[model samples]
Target chain A: EAGVAQSPRYKIIEKRQSVAFWCNPISGHATLYWYQQILGQGPKLLIQFQNNGVVDDSQLPKDRFSAERLKGVDSTLKIQPAKLEDSAVYLCASSLEGGESAIYFGEGSWLTVV
Target chain B: AQSVAQPEDQVNVAEGNPLTVKCTYSVSGNPYLFWYVQYPNRGLQFLLKYITGDNLVKGSYGFEAEFNKSQTSFHLKKPSALVSDSALYFCAVRLYTGRRALTFGSGTRLQVQP
Candidate 1:
């Protein structure tokens, strides 16, 4: 079975530019998540969606970060007017269920904001 | 509020020796723990999870973690480490109640010397 799929494995943008990352979860997975991993740090939860509805996004930066999973199968995370602190890897993951389930992750989209 | 803590920043072990990476977590109710490994410039790969039923959970790449409820710790362990096992390890936890997203700790770097 194929694992989670992500696109644009690497990205670079200026401080005021915008960037986006896409993710396609595993088949039949019901939970999708977006995480940000700064260098030398662990993955931080940015947003989580169960089906088309958001489950949690408390840690997300509301001002510039936004994510949506319209069809529940694919997701997109966007950062508008990126900052230097936004230079990190954006990871997309999926699980069979919302809670108490093993999650699988994609290769991640690396973003370098200059 | 849920949180995870990885006490060590880096650990060095000779190949074929035992290794351990420590982690602790805090949650209101029951905790769901997880361990993930990440190679350089890559997304996290699920190593193991401890939901219930067992104290010791074995996972991929011959890695195992023991859940100690009394101490609120879940430390990843490998009996015989290999040079390929050098990577970053992260520990995560979630409350058994409302939120389903995980809170990850700062990662620990494992360096296995050959």
Candidate 2:
């Protein structure tokens, strides 16, 4: 089976610009997640989707960040008016289910805001 | 809510020596614990997980983790360190309440000397 896939391996943009990253989860996986990893910090959950419906987004910076998993297959994370703090790696992951199944991650999209 | 902690910023060990990376977690309910490794400029790769069965869980790359309910910890261990094993390791937790997202620790950088 193919693993999760991501596009645009690296991107550098000025602050206030907008950028988007795409993700394709493994086939038959029902859960998708977006995580932001800042330097020297853990990867933080930005949002979660269960077959196209959002399950969580409490940590997402709604004011500047947005994500959607349409058709329950592929996902896109967007950062508008990107802040300097938004510079980090965006990781996309998917799993068969919640607790017991294995979760797999993509290579991630690296972003830098200048 | 759930959270993870990697107490060590980094761990150093010589090749062929045993190595351990410490992790602890907090949650109101029972947790599903996991360990992941991230190489430079890459996404996280699953190492192992502890759901319910044995206290010791083993996974990819000869890596294993021990789950301790009393200690509220899941520590990643390797029988013999290799230079290729030098990378950042992250601890994560997710609840069984149907939400499939994960909360990750700050990460531990492991440096295996040749």
Worst 10 residues of 1 chain B by lDDT: B94-103
**Chain A TM-score values, per prediction:** 0.97, 0.97
Report the Cα lDDT for residue A73, model 2: 96
The lDDT per prediction is 0.92, 0.92
Pairs of colliding residues, candidate 2: none
Candidate 2 stretches greater than 4 Å from native: none
Off by over 4 Å in 1: none
Please, what are the lDDT tens digits per residue for candidate 1 over residues B10-112?
A: 9999999999999999999998999999898788899999989889999998999999999999999999999999999999998876657878999999999
lDDT comparing candidate 2 with the true structure: 0.92
**Native contacts recovered, each model:** 0.71, 0.83
Q: Tell me each candidate's RMSD, in Å, in order.
A: 1.1, 1.0
lDDT of 1 by residue, A1-114 (tens): 999999899998899999989999999999999999888888888999999999889889989999999998999999998999999999999988746887889999999999
